[model samples]
Target: MLALSAVHETLGKILEPPTLHTAVIFTPAGQLVSWQSNPLCAKDDVHLVIGLSGDAWQGAREKGYGMVHHNHLGKILVVPVEDVERKPGEDKPPLMLLALNATDEMEWADMQVKGKALGAALTKSWSKHREHLTVPKPPQSSVAILTGSKRVTTR
Candidate 1:
């Protein structure tokens, strides 16, 4: 089972290089699970993130896509991690909210790639390790990337 530390580590590594400012992993009810933020971020920032993400999550559910928003501050993305195949009466979260705040517009483009990658990694990792971990970290053991039409699987 993975630990919270591992989840934070994965988020740090993924957001640090891309100049992303902050991220919060929250539940559908807006409760925080984990987060990583630069020194510039404040606790209030987290609330704003959750508020935006919660609304976006609802929209995403209706539209059937990840939610990305641009604002004067930068960009915000909310992604839901849900298990469609789970049985009834489970204790798992309905969906997790992943909210990101980038530093600039250019970083938004970079975020799309890294954000989706992070979402995918977390979704897979969490489902596999949820029995013991509050949140899942990206795999640290091996790295894989797509090379051709064959398609690579990392989950």
Candidate 2:
């Protein structure tokens, strides 16, 4: 399994400083697999919820974006990180690593385009390490029907 720390380090090396805040990987079932971000959000489960939301994941896939770490279904979501300030007179929360300034909207758009290339690179990398990950396959029923079956079992 890919470790969260490794994901973070890899992203940090690839993305520019302004866009290198955090990266998260989630299972198709919406479970958080690995994530690296500001300590505040890292420990906050709410961020995980946002990362694993079905809408976000599906949207990325529909847009043809995501890390193809293996042949399995997965997505890479890039969104504006919310800036949080602690209560009055308190210290500021740790800034997210990939958070970009509002004025960098154009840069963010560029990054999204670049993200597509990154996805392709990931696909190639994963293909080279295919033995390490399970590649999901389409259901057999969807591909062919068993017509010569002697018995049918329904549970």
Candidate 3:
């Protein structure tokens, strides 16, 4: 799991623009990881935005536009956080960064640059932290059966 504080700090820096209302880190499947907003946006709203972004992202790819594509929403910018350390054909999904309310060309440009930096930072953190991820092993035990008055092990 990525550090929430670190993610928020990176997002906070990107949300420097007055028009930029919110920034979210989420998967292409709409799982929100982290977010930072200027006026305290709701989690539900963030989820909705991410969902729309995911659809737009998919549409863009389907149209052969590539990962980086501007959606019809106009104000939202979805940037893909690609993991450089990941091997080819790896099943790991890349994270997406979405910024809300980039009204003009300059703001859009600003978001693109800052969003890329945030993506790179997040990818690095995710790659580093993933090394420490561990799965819990199942417990090993002998099966017990009660016949009449005694317990018998059936391992």
- Among all candidates shown, the one with the greatest lDDT: 1
- Model 1 scores worst on lDDT over the 10 consecutive residues at 129-138
- Tens-digit lDDT track of model 1 for 82-151: 5545566665554566777776644555666777677777777676644443444448865566788676
Instruction: Give per-residue CA lDDT, model 3, range 32-83, as digits (tens).
Output: 7788888776777777678766766676643311222335333676766766
Worst 10 residues of 3 by lDDT: 61-70
Write down the lDDT that model 2 would get. Answer: 0.39
Q: Give the Å shift of residue 128 in candidate 3.
A: 3.9
Which model, 1 or 3, shows the larger lDDT?
1
Which regions of candidate 3 are displaced past 4 Å?
62-74, 86-92, 95-101, 104-106, 129-155
lDDT of 2 by residue, 1-155 (tens): 44567655655445443333445444443444455443324345434444444444445533433221112212234332112322454432111212111123234456566544544444444444434443355566555334686545433
lDDT of 2 at 85: 23
Greater lDDT among 2 and 3 belongs to 3
Q: Look at candidate 1 and tell me the lDDT of residue 21.
A: 74
Winner by lDDT between candidate 2 and candidate 1:
1
Model 1 ranges with Cα > 4 A deviation: 62-72, 84-94, 107-109, 129-155
